[model samples]
Target: MPYSRTDLKLEIQTHFDKGFSRDLKILDVGPGAGMYGGLLSEYSDILDYSLGFELDCLEIYPPYIEKFKLKEIYKNVFIGDICTFNISSYDYIILGDVLEHLSIDNAKKVLNTINKNNQKCMVAVPYLSEQGEHEGNIYEAHLQPDLTPEIMKQRYPSLKLLYGNDSYGYYVNYNFNKMKETLVIEYNNLFKKPIKPIYPKNEFKVNFIKGCKFEVIGENKNNYHVEFINQKTNKVIYETDITNNMWTKPSLEYFVDFKIRITDQNNVVWENKFNAENKRVYIHFASNAIGDTLAWFPYAEEFRKKHKCKLIVSTFWNDWFKDTYPNITFVEPGEEQHDLYAMYEVGWHYNEDEDIDYNRIPSNFRKMPLSKTAADQLGLEYREIKPKLSFKKNKSQISGDYVVIAPHASSHAKYWNYKGGWQTVVDYLNDKGYKVVMITKEPMYDDWHDSKLGGTLKGVINKTGNFPLDERANDIMNAKALIGIGSGLSWLSWALGTPVVMISGFSEPYSEFEDCERIYAPKGKCGGCFNKVRLDAGDWEWCPEHKDTDRHFECTTSIKPQVVIDAINRQLEKTP
Candidate 1:
């Protein structure tokens, strides 16, 4: 919606003034961030301008998404390419100097799509131009240089040409004043209301084998509408407002596809598909993060053996879920039909002021591994928490028996070896005649600290790369034992049936692991500040108490190398 007044932009603004009313929805196709000129700035000078009418924008860059989101300027921002995404019908779909950036075929496709959708089209491109890309995306390099008014007219004969220059290809002008008198009524018929937002709490849930229900706990529930969709047939099976604080589910026998669409008063729409089956009862795991998702596999395994129904996991890690459990169904959160779904919740942020919400999380839930806690809460026959990957074993980098020493973490504070502690561990393992493999994917990973593992100790392997996550999971499973921080591998190794020596820098031992030796920083001294509220482990940022301490990150530095070695020895001693 925002644009700067380059001469071409001004001309486009004049066309809007000449034809469009404030009511007709206008779309700016691939409008460059217009960093220099947001919406109103195009009509006036840069010095004084204010955002006026709500505008729609389609941008691809993430930074731009955040910028527009924070600006709250646009009614909606579609974070995708105009070519691939659906080009809906609009009163005015302006291509503000945007055509040259796309391949000729893509540009033609967009123009054809808009035309087919019966939407008004505007064009602007550089004639016979070289690569003139704006900032950020490299693919933004201009591709259609030979774009000219003659070519556009030939491609789209019905288009009425306004002005064309060697610099800017074409502006297909519309005599909106004449259209307002003649075609305004016909055009307004195509106008759509503004989109709104709704909620089931999360993005989507899949396979609500039956139907889902909601209980809106707040007054804002009156402002939104919840919808259930049959995915395969594209049917709205149910939709209603939560005025009574009761979101009851509709009786659905069997649905091939399941989706939830939430629309708010303003017409904003958010839809997500959750995997659901009509006949089978399913397990609903409450999580969206990878670590939390992986923690549920043990329960899934036990649940699978006991029940004939499939496991329905609600998480964002769809591919990971599918790859991990070929038979299990994965869905986004909140799409589960509560009438069919039996929610398995571990924790929620400390937000609800009522007792009802707090009652959902089982007491002492945070005190033990969720696998055991959940199993006990459900009164299921408790089995040893054995998390094993269903995927076949992957090849290892080193052939011989090796103990993986994971030194890298999401943050430096979680690391046990900031000051030569890991060097001692690797050297300790090397003397023990066991190869030490270090695997990591932290982009900000420093190597100087790992100078000793510089492929010098023929026994040490640095298996770090941008490889698939499965390979990492497989490595953890096959390793003799894993000596790592409180990371995904730490969780995976334990679940994959391999013993783990867990070293914690920012968390307590009870909450994360059991049946294993754990070394943690004392809470009084920068330790165990994790839960829903204080979620992040050190990501180069420090916990408040440890940030500027005279001890220099004593939380992690406090753990001695021998402590890790002893833990590893204890685990290895029990192996086989």
Candidate 2:
């Protein structure tokens, strides 16, 4: 159970002598022979640097504490598992042949934990070396035998190779603390990516700025003045003086050319601009709403192309966009990303307070188109960008000239409330030599209105049931045209390149995509309340402004069934 190699220990000592301050806290994990601990303790007792080092030893095997005299070498000898041990307080950590013993996931988690806490770490592993349990210590066996310099770099991108050979490799993560000095803005739609901020370390001294956690370590924190500037226009975005040792800012940020200037006590100024070129940037879709995700997805690609960043995106519906966009990395919700240059979130922010919502979006979301909100948040040019969907191609269940109608929405307010609206359109389509297929997750029943909103109409094929999204997309793809409300299916129909005849009066025409054939009551007829008023989700029959009046719900009720028929006819004519 003793380490035979002295070269690695000497190399580590050389690194320490070169730059590391003697006044530091160190943790030696799984020190087999206590060689590194002994060396650190010897330095602690010798001459002027004698009263500086605080060395701790974490040995998993309790017997090793006595066998190696770890008690004499370390100031505190803690007997515990290294994988679960809290390494946050230490300034430097040495994982000497410790990672090879842990499972691959546990090994990665250990490194991730250390890096996340901004701790400087040194890891050494025997390259492709295989060993079984040594002595009575079962923890001495190498669980990972194929670890190499290339494999380590691939698995842990933050690690920098200090020294390596065919026998062993010594990796250092000094850059782990680099994230702390840089601002990390995280947006979580489905997945989160931390944007890395570049800092000139020698000039302005600030440590730790990842996410919402911020810390500054220097003699006098009051002497530090930080200013955030918009690099594009030279306007000051934010400025603050560091009064305490720790300062944290809100994680949400506008996608802009961020320039940071820091003035230290000596009046030494440091400035750096936000650059994500070749760096990983994350954009998350916080809302799981299908329409919102589809509308915002195009801008995510645009952000990637514009910034020239390695883009990672998270959406509730990743399968819909993953295949079509092979260039972008799509992750599931809540997956962690390391070494991110910047992060952004794209979705509808419902908070009416400008103070709260302005951090997420620059302007009122209700005033902008659904897709334009993403464009505005990311500082991209406003334009309609349709996301291409990839799905399994199969014969649509309904074979022949058919028209798909999705009449259900989350709220009854988004439904087409015209009298006999859906049935009349179904009859009209049936008379127009087209089979009408109703594709909804389920029949919509509005309890407040005490009526079934969308169900199988007479003389129409009822395809309404809980079906897979890709399957529904395929059905929409094969259809000649789709008639739906201001719902996800209407957006899906448009994304599939199908002519969409959208019938809804609760929202403005600009609220949805412009290309869709939108049918709404004129402005004076009491429409567009969904965009103007804060939607009361609990109220099933929410008729804002005109509620309980003669004109209650007249926005859609006033829109006759003939208007929808004409829109559908016009769309079909234009498409064919």
lDDT of each: 0.59, 0.75
Off by over 4 Å in 1: 1-288, 300-311, 317-328, 331-347, 352-360, 364-366, 372-384, 443-459, 521-526, 531-533, 536-539
Model 2 clash pairs are: 180-208, 180-209, 181-208, 189-284, 189-285, 189-286, 195-341, 195-342, 196-341
lDDT of 1 by residue, 1-576 (tens): 122224444334334444556666767666554432254323333213332445677776656555333245456667787888766746667786677677777877887787777777777666666664455466567676676677767765656766555556445534444644434443344333321221112222233333445444422335557777766568887887645345546554322245677677858456666532333444555555455666655666465555545556555555654765676677776674444443444333233552323334334454455556556433355555655455567787678888876656666556673466766777888888788777666421355544422323244576776657778877776788988777777777776777888888666677675766788875556666553234454346556565665665677667777777887888889876
Please give the clash total of every predicted structure, in order: 32, 9
Quality of model 2 by C-alpha lDDT: 0.75
Q: Please report how far candidate 1 places residue 269 from its true position, in Å.
A: 41
Return the TM-score for candidate 1, rounded to 2 decimals.
0.45
Among the numbered candidates, top TM-score falls to 2
Expressed as tens digits, the lDDT of each residue in 25-51 for candidate 2 is 889999876767755556422122432
Which residue segments of model 2 deviate by more than 4 Å? 1-222, 243-245, 248-252, 265-268, 350-356, 444-450, 453-456
Model 1, residue 110: C-alpha shift (Å): 54
